[model samples]
Target chain A: MQWSHNMRFFQSYAMKKQLWIIVVIIIAAILPTIIGAFWINVAVEILIMGLFAVSFNMIFGYMGQLSFGHAAFYGVGAYTVGLLMAKLSIPFSLSLIAAMLSAGAFALIIGYFCIRLTGIYFAILTLSFGQLIYYIVFEWYSFTGGDNGLQGIAAPHLLSSVTAYYYFTLVIVIAALIVMWYISRSPFGYTMRAIRDNANRTRFLGINVKRYMLINFVIAGAFAGLAGGLWGPFNQSISPDLLNWTESGIPVFMTVIGGSASFLGPMVGSIIYTFLNAFVTGFTQYWPLIIGIVIMLIILFSPGGIQGLIDKWYKHSDSSDENIEL
Target chain B: METGGRNSGSKSEREEITGESMDFSLIFSQFLSGLSRGAMLFLIASGLSLIFGVMNILNFAHAALWLVGAYLAYTFWNLLQPYGFSLWVSIPLAAVALSAIGWAIERVLIRRIYNRTLSEQLVFTFAMILVIDNLIKIIWGVQDKAIVRPSIVASPVFIFGAPLDSYFIFVIFTGAVVAIGLWWFLSKTKYGHIIKAAVFSREMVSALGIPVPKIYTWVFVLGIFLAGLAGGVQAPIGSITLGMDNAVIIQAFIVVVIGGFGSLLGTLVGSIIVGEIYAFSILFWPDGAMILIFVVAAIMLIIRPWGLFGTPMRT
Candidate 1:
């Protein structure tokens, strides 16, 4: 009788949580309509970067590896889309697929070399690979338009309108997030976590750690490419600078600042960083300095990030029920 | 085997060009340029290797310090020019300024993060790069600055029948002097042994009444000083631009990685190898010169991930 009561209580709590999620989703759906044009555009950027960060988190947070060159995949995706649309006049859907495939290929090649090394060495190799991609893209002047980049990327008629494009991006991001969430909860994710926690022990258990990491890397790259594909049409241009190591640092910053411990941490980081970028750049060209100082403070003072602070506050306020999961 | 073939190929090419029984003169010119390039790399990579050796921290901001060194040299040159000062005076002055800045960074920021994770250390130093890059813009403006060579060393000298720039010779000489000085300090001096011992076991050194933190601060300062000195010297050869820091830093990183981080002799050999490769590759494969560095480093990792001289970590 006690077990039945406990199950009923949990069901009710789960239903309530689902309801809350539905409400948040509805709010997000209608947000662009209520916001100004400028804010809506910013929202588009936030959504794209948020997706990128979430994908990045799969490796950094879930897999316990930091890839310092994630932007290379993102740039590859953008360039693939831009080139396909500008040169071959491929349809939007096909171009998007191509972008993901290309980025996935890139991740596979880079990760083959990278996954063998751990910690700082992995970070450096990824960084070097990222720079290599940037240099190639920068130097291939005829095809990539050199440093000028590709412009006038064509979008499908349905996505021609800014509002329509925004909604399209919103739907794609939400679907991607759902798929990502499912994957995280799957057996593969558990193995990933196992490897991350103790790779040697995981290896002793007869699991091929490197292969799993490579697959995760490919998945992460594909998602980043998807975001980059969206970005090319949104901006109507793409540059080699997109692949710069400094740009790679953005996802890292977002993951760390948003809290790398939780599922939603990188998304939160993306949102905060997007807003911070939009807000700070409006006032000063010294944005790098401000962003640098803010990140430093976050590292020094709030190592666990915003989510961590919230968890602490929740624990303090609700001592009777301290087992809340976020 | 392939490298051997490439070397002989280049030598034959040199022989054909010079049209001589002995192409020693032609080879000598290549050697001279390689030495100069390697020396500059050494100045930067040694510092990077030393810091990693001691603290296990890959200081990204070291590159920014190089930029600071260049800009400071520019500023000091302009100021001292009115008072009849030379490039020599300005270069050393810039080095001192950088040392101060490096010391401040260690004491105020890096000193607190000795026990933090590697990711945190990288990001924190990366943040410093952003701050310093922007600060350079705010202080020095966005324009590239050029420094004229000192009048005393403005002309080329005929060495081994090659007209090498006097400034290049000076740079080579400075690098050699520093290399010898560092060698003496590390291998022959008591302080050098202390630093090495500290790198091997920090706790044991501390337990033996050594102020490990103080030693670390000084070592970091020394690293900074080298970076600054490199920038000051390089400023005359190339214009100081916004992106120069990243350009040099990446190359220096490749040098350190190839040489094996935390090993002085490794750094020396790595720099020379890289420098020679860079010098010759420009002649044979101009378009892919930069890519060659990455390729070599990749091969090195494949063959020996711990680097040529670096000790592998115990997992």
Candidate 2:
């Protein structure tokens, strides 16, 4: 059996090209279960953060906003779920739903105020909102456990099996990614790209630019929150550190490292970053310094990022296009 | 963001009625404490503003210069401590040493990134912050170190019927001197005029044969040196620690935001406002103070996105 370049390449034996990507996703989902537990867990982190970074790209790459405070939504998701399960006796699945909605709601409010600003002002406003959330979480000691963080957050018993959890996460990731992919290709995405490419031109076209910005911003926040929901149960806890500006930068860095413009670029970057982080921490205490240096070098020299490098190499070697979907 | 909701809680009123202890003379000392911190903030912030305004480079690693100053001050103080050299002497020497370090950073790392966007500049500077902070940790260890207070500053001075530490007076003096010197440099000198012109239009200035890149290098070096000087002056009052860089940078950032990004007078007014707020808030509401200042900033941003004194950018 041979793989077809296009599902619609043959008129009678046709489907959509996106289905090929879905098939690849299905293979990725199953391959992890057969892998070792540690690798599976690491794959889960990559998937989650990959999702997180891509969500960030919606605002940063597509909308031309530079947010230094996205961890606000991520942390809200974590803490919302953590507090709900701990205090309100909410079911885990419902808690995740509630967490995502509330996070989206918060993003909507923050995005409403923030959409009015542009460039660095938008960055600062988002940051201030993030800091405000950090303050509340840090100070509300009795409820959020303050700096110590809420601990011992157990998932449903079915997810106690690492492989089971892997499959479960794989399914959710596929769903989430599809939703995000759909969002990016939708009319909304086109308008966002227009706004990013030329705000003045888009405004002159009679589009409700700020309204479109808020919609995408809230959607991105929702996906980020969903990613955070995965994180809390996987890690068994959430801390204020998860919500800080530094944590926010991880997604930004990974997105940049992976190639923010590509759909699957963040996934690739997260895998490399996570693996490198684990390995480097084992070898030396100064991991952040090394990582920081690498990030700087990459940004300065390789503006197109890892995916960009691969694309350049491919183009250089062959006149015919042989490119990865991402 | 909690929006300063008008339905005031009891906690809000409780914030309005706090009193100072009879050991209240310590209050004046603490007021000085805030002033010195304010001065340090001004030093770092003014440099950051200049780098932002003149170079159009939001170089986050500029914070590292403060750490460099503090570290150099620590080393100098240790060497001179055995010889009985006061912090006064060590600080100036350390400031000079850090100026050289600033020159090196400009020549090596910063000069290369002048053509980059603000986001790219931010990434470069962020990495530098991490690398420099950790290099200091590796060399100095994670432990904190302090410069000895000069004997003159150890003595108390009478002010407004309150006793103040002489070191506080010294801090105020250094801040005043630096502020005046910076004013003279910016407002009363030909170089200042060139830098201002460069700030507004790099291409036009370079077209006129002003050596714009050289000016950029000088501006960055001078900015970092001023930050280092601030750090050096702060060494006697505080410990030099790796994490010290973070808080100082944030405080500097707030000052920059409050001061109008590129204005020196704005930095001064902003620092004083923030300093006084922090000082009074400690007495009133311990937890709410920092958040309140940010709240003030958020409001300012909404009302005048350019800041109190900053000119609005052309979109």
Candidate 3:
């Protein structure tokens, strides 16, 4: 009787989580209808970045592998789509797919070598590569437009309307997030967390720890690429700076700001960053100053961010999952 | 952004004013140019490499320090413009001023997170990039500023078959002097040996009653001095702008990687290699040079792992 009652409670909680996602989708789908195109553009950017940050969180939070070159994938996706449309006159969907493949291929090649180093070595190595990509884009004037970047990229007919584009982006992001959420809950996630908590123990348990990390790495790179792919049509242009180390820092900032441990934190962090940028930069050119200071204070104080704060509040009220580690 | 050029170039030059205008002597001048550029690179990369060695922190702000040095030189030059002593006086003054800034950076910002993760180090330094660059723009106004080699009536000297600029020669000489100074400081002096001792074993050094944190501050200050000197020397050669920090800093990191961390000799050699690549690439294929160096650094790391002379990771 006691076991059956616990099972029933678990099922009820699972159902509530699923319903929560649906509610979010419904609200997100109708958001642009209520707001203007300007806000919608900001929303689109935030959505793309949310996917990027969440993808980053998978590696940084779940796997405890910090990468400063995530922008390589992001840039590869954006540039792949941009180059295809610029030169080959490829279809929108096809270009996006190509973008994802290119990003994955690029990630695997870099990761093959980078995986050898752990800790700060790995981070700096990735960073150098990220800057290298940026330089390629900046200097390869003949092919990459030589820093002027690819201009005049436009959304496809289906995505011509802001409302339509918002809905389209929302659908894709929702599907991606659902997939990510599922992956996070699967046995794979358990193994990942184990590896993060103690790599030697997991390896002792017969897991190919490096292989597990590589799989998560490629997957993270692909989703970040997907974010980059979406950015192409939305912005209608791309630049090599998109893959620079500084640009790669975004998701890390967002991941930490959103509390990397929780799946929902990064998405919320992205929303917060976007909304803040919308109002803040409009007021002055020195907005990064304000944003940087705020993030510093957040890191210094909260460490786990808003989700971290929420967890602490919930903890005081006696939640069932008391073992949450930020 | 594609700055529109030929998707397919014409078979021949549209206008060739050249009738074998090349000079064999240009090779010597090119070598001289390479050395000068190498010196500037050495100054920047050495500072960055040292910081990486002792602190085990990848500072994103070193390039900003370079920018600050150049800006200080510019400001001092303007203040002392009417007086003939400005050019000679400004460089040392620029370096000294920036040392205080470096001290503040170490004490206030970097000290706070000495024990944090690499991601935290990266994030905090990155924040400085935003704050520092914006501070530069706010203070200087967003206009390009130039630091012309203080009007010293410099003349070119002929070496082998080519004439080399005096300023270029000075840069090369400055680099050598700095290298020797650093080496002697590290080897002969007690403090220098203590730093290397700390580098070899931080805990052992600390257990021996030395203050590791104080050593870190000194390392940071010394590194800052070198970076400021680099900026002061390069003032005449390049543009002084807020964002120049990013380019210089990235290049410095690449050099540090190739040279291996904490090895000044490696930094010097690495700078020369990168410098030669820069000079020759511009002479030949301009597009892929910068990217090619990065590719080289990546390949070097794969092969050597710890860099050419870098100490193995004991941490």
Which of the two, 1 or 3, has more lDDT? 1
lDDT of 1 by residue, B16-104 (tens): 54455335655676778888999999998999889988888889888888889989999999888766555789999999999999999
Q: Lowest-lDDT window of 10 residues in candidate 3 chain B? A: B1-10
Per-residue lDDT tens digits for candidate 1, residues A78-192, read 9999999999999988999999999999999988888898887777788778877887888788889878999999689989887888899999999988888888878898888
Backbone atom clashes (below 3 Å) for every candidate? 0, 0, 7
Off by over 4 Å in 1: A1-24, A317-326, B1-30, B158-163
Residue B145 lDDT in model 3?
A: 79
Off by over 4 Å in 2: A1-27, A30-35, A316-325, B1-31, B155-165
Docking class of 1: acceptable
Q: Tell me, what's the RMSD of every candidate?
A: 5.4, 7.4, 6.8
The reply for model 3, stretches above 4 Å from the true place, is: A1-23, A317-326, B1-24, B153-158, B161-163
Predicted structure with the largest lDDT when compared to the true one: 1
Tens-digit lDDT track for model 3 on A186-290? 889888889888899999999998888888888888888889988988888888888888888888888777888688888989988888889888888888788
Location of the lowest summed lDDT over 10 successive residues in candidate 2 chain B: B1-10
* C-alpha TM-score for every candidate: 0.91, 0.89, 0.90
